[model samples]
Target chain A: MINNRVFPWLDERLGLTTIYKTVLDRMVPKVNWWFTLGSATLFLFVMQAVTGIMLSVYYVPSPDKAYDSIEYIMTGVAFGWLIRGIHHWGATLMVITVFIHMLRVFFYAAYKYPREITWTTGVFLFLLTLGMGFTGYLLPWNQKAYWATTVGTSIAGSVPVIGDFILRDLRGGSDLSGVTLARFFSAHIWMLPAAIIALIGVHLYLVIRLGISSIPKENE
Target chain B: MARSGNVTRRGFITSVMAFAGSIMGIVVGLPIIGYLVSPAIGGRKTDSWIPVGKLDTYPVGVPTVFSFTRSKINGWEKTTNSYSVYVLRGANDEVKVLSNVCTHLGCRVSYSKDTDTYACPCHDARFDRNGVVLSGPPPRPLDQYESKNDNGTLSIRVLES
Candidate 1:
């Protein structure tokens, strides 16, 4: 009832009808459920945001409390284990979906022609997702996180001339300490998420603007 | 574009999208609500009997300040808190412990033998030997700790909110 009465009135000013027609109501190419991966990846990102925010409620970024805080979330807080489980798995699944979605586009030649920019953005999204995984992996401050990050940064330090700068920049110093944890946490929750969200906005706008590509047929 | 009597291509796509979107919503919606509100609703109280020292160590008719460290779990970290209290020894083996925290702005209050009154350096709030507010802007008297003596050892029951 509210939609029938209020939608038209609001749509006049907001162009809701125009958006619906152009964005959702337009005819897309006939495709199978493989087309759903893009949407699925988007859904997983939303899940990441929800669960990540919930985790941040109790998560401490400091070296002393980061591990214990996660322990507290897993054991003490109600439904915290479930939220974190979803986030952890959702991140893994998102990487898979985005990668497969890119493959699907490549196979169909959907990245050709007018979709070049969209394809470029999609690649960036894939790399950013991996970046998210990398940054997020070190937040728990356990033996795994500490050693893995230590080895990971050391690899960067092995690079040519600028290796030392890269390693120091990543760790916030020569060693992994409270500052390193703080930096990773900031990137995990803030910097990487911002980049991903902005890229996603561009990705979706292009998807809607150019319309999804159709499955290729035998050439003449 | 043909409707085929009822459903169009656009209509079918919209419905399927809606269904899938709702599935996403239902999967993560409920648990996230419970997760976000869990900490705010669940809080634990800490209380203990903190021992001061031998009862005779505090001289009679004078208030002596004693401070100690109290550690408790604040979320994921163990936070150490400093708490000081004034121990007053009255006649007839009566012992009263008043929190050294000023009732006005939470500054430490010290006992001045010259004025014979507890003085808060922050706001110059003064209290009598009994810890009743005497002057300045303290709306209430200094908070008292329930104390007892066991074998000449004085301890106070501390309840933290």
Candidate 2:
């Protein structure tokens, strides 16, 4: 009785009833555990954002102090190890889920017709996720990070005429110096996150607009 | 017509609510913007003289290992780090403090007395007594801290890369 009265009041004030009927009253086809991968990927992204924020609180981006700061976070800060571990594992899990989601969409022919834009956005999001991984890998500033980045950027330098340009842009110079660390730190923490968030907005909007695709059947 | 000239009840309330919301957003957003941009705009590293040890303790004509604890504050995080360096004292009382980190890949380089060189265990990079790169994949010489001998105490100013 109270909900009836309160809901009417809210609907009268904010038009909530109209929004609920339009957005929440939609029909969804029968889906199994496979359908949950997209939601799982979304959940992992949120987890990454939360843990990444906590990490940014203690992570220093300089060449001089980056590794030490991570060590401090792992050993010194309270519950730091758990949070960092979650962030690390969450990133790996997100990549896995996103790949699975893409495969499910492709194999079911869900990307056909109206869902082409959705598939394209998903591809972009996949590349951005990989970019996030690559950039975040270098922020630790360990021997592995330093050498791997040197090797990674050198591969970028192997691309035809634009190779050196891409390499210099990525490293911020001819050599992997402090500037590279700072640049990667900024890209990892700020620019990529911002881009991912914006892309996620579009991706979610498209998903909702088109509704979830049903699994392909043997017969029509 | 006169009733139409007056604002509707819903319109007046919504206008007031929107104004309040804008004010709230500005109040919350300003500090967040400042916090995000401060690290990029602020000075890179804090400059200070770290005291290593006494001049008398460092043996002459030998690379004595000295480890010192330095606290570094970067934005919101503060870390107390123990760093090692090789301090070689000359006959004329001049001191050379070489950073033990290899120039190749930032691994800790240890002094091998038998080989008379600082060798990195990670990549087999070697540096001679003068901190010059001897062999392997090191691109440059080992880094050195600017050391100062004040009276009988030794202090060093760490250079940022």
Candidate 3:
């Protein structure tokens, strides 16, 4: 068949058959729906990235115009409401799925022994995900957003010796001015995203490198 | 010995290719990254004087509502925002522009002719014609915009919050 000829041609030039055999033919323990949460989290992350990028195409990050721009997106652009709604809901869903995934890993005690690196990286990933949510919440610059951020950053100022420094660093100044909006906007869209992607790469590499931990049997 | 020599040559070729590939990646990636991040670094909204309307249109001794649209560009995205201001013009050409947003929770305050006061539906806050809080939960007076009357035309300078 033509399929046989094309596959062999590709296999000869690219060693596709060898890669498939090595990666896809590996054995895994029989897992239930709980084991699928990790993949679900990954899918949600991709969805968030795509939707977030679409939103950034029209979102303004300045305090003076952020709310207005959001209004424009909601009323003027076609399907803008749908996209924004999905992004809003998707973020909440991603947080939930990630939390559930972590719980699954912990309850299974998969974080023990040789998988220590994987667990540690996962902890960082969880914190990074929360950071993304916190930063993104302020981009709208509405009343709730402004007040919530004011309170949130003030809490950071309550930490000991370096507290003021942390607050100033987060807000880009002593107060939540336009500079704070700009800072959070950049962190939400750029810095945190880069960190998340890098961490995800390493996490996945570790997972594959160590192979998935099997479920503990009743007698074992 | 022949097999060992062949393996060493393959290893050397692989390392050289890896180095070349990385160099190419940097050369191609830097410009793309710069293009993407330039907006975040350089795009700060500047204060500008936005024209509202002609001075005579605003009635004296009463707060007349005027709505205007301001277009903003953040990076590549452009959006138009509609804003409303209560313009109070005095007999002696004294002009005051008050933001409709409530001081309590940032809700839009509307003029109620029945009560002759500006009221917020969000928290039942009220403000007099001069924008001073009359009742309810407003923490402060309504915000005012810096306005100018130039050749019978009125404009307001919006400041960054």
TM-score of each model, in listed order: 0.83, 0.57, 0.57
Write out the backbone clash pairs for model 3: none
Regions more than 4 Å wrong, model 3? A1-15, A18-24, B1-161
Q: Tell how far residue A121 is off in model 3, in angstroms.
A: 0.8
Q: Would you give the TM-score of chain B in model 2? A: 0.70
Per-residue lDDT of candidate 1, residues B31-78 (tens digit): 777777776776778788999999999989888989999888766777
Off by over 4 Å in 1: A1-9, A154-165, A173-177, B1-30, B41-47, B102-108, B114-116, B119-126, B135-139
Judging by lDDT against the true structure, name the best candidate.
1
Better of 2 and 3 by lDDT: 2
Ranking under DockQ, best-scoring first? 1, 2, 3
The C-alpha lDDT values of all candidates are 0.90, 0.86, 0.84
| DockQ, every prediction | 0.65, 0.02, 0.02
Clashing pairs in 2: none
lDDT of each residue in A14-111, candidate 1, tens digit only: 99889889988988989999899999999899889978988899999998888899999998888888988988899899999999998999888999
- Residue-by-residue lDDT tens digits, candidate 3, A1-220: 7567987888899998777766667667787898887788888888788778877877888877788878866765555677788789988998999899999999889999898988998999899999988998888888888988999999999999999999999999999999999999999889998998998888887777777888888875
Deviation from native of the Cα of residue A86 in model 2, angstroms? 0.6
Residue B73 lDDT in candidate 2: 68
lDDT string, candidate 2, A78-119, tens digits: 566777898889988899999998888888889988988888
What's the residue-level lDDT of A150 in candidate 3? 93
Residue B68 alpha-carbon offset, candidate 1, angstroms: 1.8
